[model samples]
Target: MKQSPATPLPSPKERRRLREAGSLTQAQVAERVGVTREMVRAWESGRTNPRGRKREVYAKLLGTLAEEEEPRRPEVTEPQETLVEPAPPAPPLTPAQAFDALYAFCAPALVRQAYLLTGRRELARESVERAFQLAWQRWPEVAVDRDPAGWVRATAYEYALSPWHRFRPRYRHPEAPPADASDRALMAVLLRLPTPQRRTLVLYDGVGLDLPETAAETEASTPAAAGRLMNAREAIAARLPELSDPAELHRRLTELAATERLRAAKPPVVRTGSERRARFWTRAAIAFTVALIGTTALTVRTAPTHYEPPIAPGAEIQGVPERVAQGPLSEAEVDLREKLRGEMTSGPVRLTPLSR
Candidate 1:
């Protein structure tokens, strides 16, 4: 049977109901259609007829509305295959390459979460950067872990909790920091809690990390980690009045993530020669300081020298000359000297004393 062309269109009340149910508001539809709320209101009320751009926007909105209004039909099942085809082999990844991949993938979400946790742009940036740097260093060990993002979040939280973050001079600027509403709201609540509690809450609830993974990242036992998360949640829940609506908060977070992704995708700026030279000198200085420290440590740890006892004095030595008789000698002494001389001239010398 041939289906007749779809009816002209549903009424504005019907369209509004669909839009509301599908998580869209009149303001959102207006922004998408580039129209004013009053115009949308009028169109919905059937007081003002929409045409051209307005008509086009209405048509698009109605179509979207209709699609959302349709019931979720059950998915059709296909015949079972006797044998499943194996997935294509993945290319092997080097540690550095894998680190870069994971960093790039998680950076947006991490940054957004950091901003939400700290409410400070600079802190968020620093936290994210340090987390990625640490991740890079331990990539070989961490890559095999089940939740790398959780690890990154935990690292970032530690970075946020570092003394520098708490003690650093605050920036005083005319313009307020630009963060989404959700980030602002979340950060306000997070900063009120102690650092450890805040970190636990952000990792588990904000970033969706499991308790064991959170514990591993935070260096806490699983039960302790769970307690922290629960405590954080309760604290936030107590201060719920300060936060915006949950739905609005979610939307703001989504927007922040999108913005970060767009910003990260842009080409990085190239450093000038002077900048490169400065960085090289800084690295060289660090290396020299480390070397000097190592040398000093080695010198301090060496054992001191001590003297040993000298060899005992001997009564007689084989290699020494015997005292010789002086002046004119008796016949016996002369005979002994002659014998000694004869012995010395031969292999070895032997002396005999004469009786008085």
Candidate 2:
């Protein structure tokens, strides 16, 4: 049977055993084969068989095949498919839509800040609402700023201090309502400070703004802002003797601030397209009426009129008389006398002279 190819040389395990008996590590064999130790282990364990240049190196390292034997080459193949394309992204919202979103996001915070500043619930709501209205009008400008919430809060504070608010018939002094022990205590401390001091402290410490930002928002100098903050702290400290530990008090105050911020946040009531259109029409109608009145006034001013004055029933007509003169009276008289003498009897010269 031609010796049956000698049983394929009893596999690589027998060779690995032979090499191990010589006190060499798998890493040393791997270096000789230009492969990892794990690869060598797999080869020795019969989990894989070396191919290509690796097979040649392995055979040489194990003294099984001659160095002159050429290495076998691995087959190459192409992929059957390609990667899938991704879907397109969604479009961005318009300014009005974005305003609606931002208003919803910041309303509560605004309300809370207003409440803290004024210490009255209704005033706080009014101030916050007015701020949101302003924000809606200037959304294109306000939305581009880095901190929209800060802008809204600053606007709400300004609204709270507006002359309209000051002069409104419904204006009421801000007063803290009855609350639980912790809230009552907090309110008492807050109430003791001046409005500016309280507002500064709340903006800086409670709302987490830095000194410069707080000063800018409050329209005060850095030193003035700092003084207000200090005064507020001192006032609160004096009122709350129980808050002896500054760190603990700060922690509690931060928690209270978080609570206040959450409470103030509320969903905004948005005006629909129809409602906005209605408002536009209403304003247009008023403007049209005013324009009509103005036009009528101008027409009356420029138009001509036929007006006649009244005459008295009886009135004398004043004028001059025509002139008349006597003709050749003297000559006529002389001639008449001569002729009468000549003809004394000439009928008495017809002294009937010319008919007068």
User: TM-scores for all candidates?
Assistant: 0.45, 0.52
List, residue by residue over 1-356, the lDDT tens digit for candidate 1.
99554335468677677777778877787788887654565566543456665676678778877786788988869866689889999999876567667777777677777766666666676677766666655666789876686677778866766765445457333224445665455556667888778667655555544566567777899999988877776776677654334334344445644454322221111112224555777899999999999999888788456667789887765777778877888999989988887774556556899999
Stretches off by above 4 angstroms in model 1 are 1-91, 94-96, 137-147, 170-186, 241-356
RMSD of every candidate to native, in Å, equals 20.1, 27.2
lDDT of 1: 0.65
- Candidate 2, residues 1-356, lDDT tens digits: the string is 57332223237667677567656787788777787665666566554576776776666666643222336757759764878889889899987678778777677666766766666677877777767766766677888886787788888888775656656666745455535578667866775677788789777666656576778878999999999988777777777766655445555566554454334333345334324655887899999999999999999998778766678699776785757777655988989988778864635343455766
lDDT of each: 0.65, 0.68
TM for candidate 2 is: 0.52
Q: What's the true lDDT of residue 68 in model 2?
A: 25
Best by lDDT: 2
Best by TM-score: 2
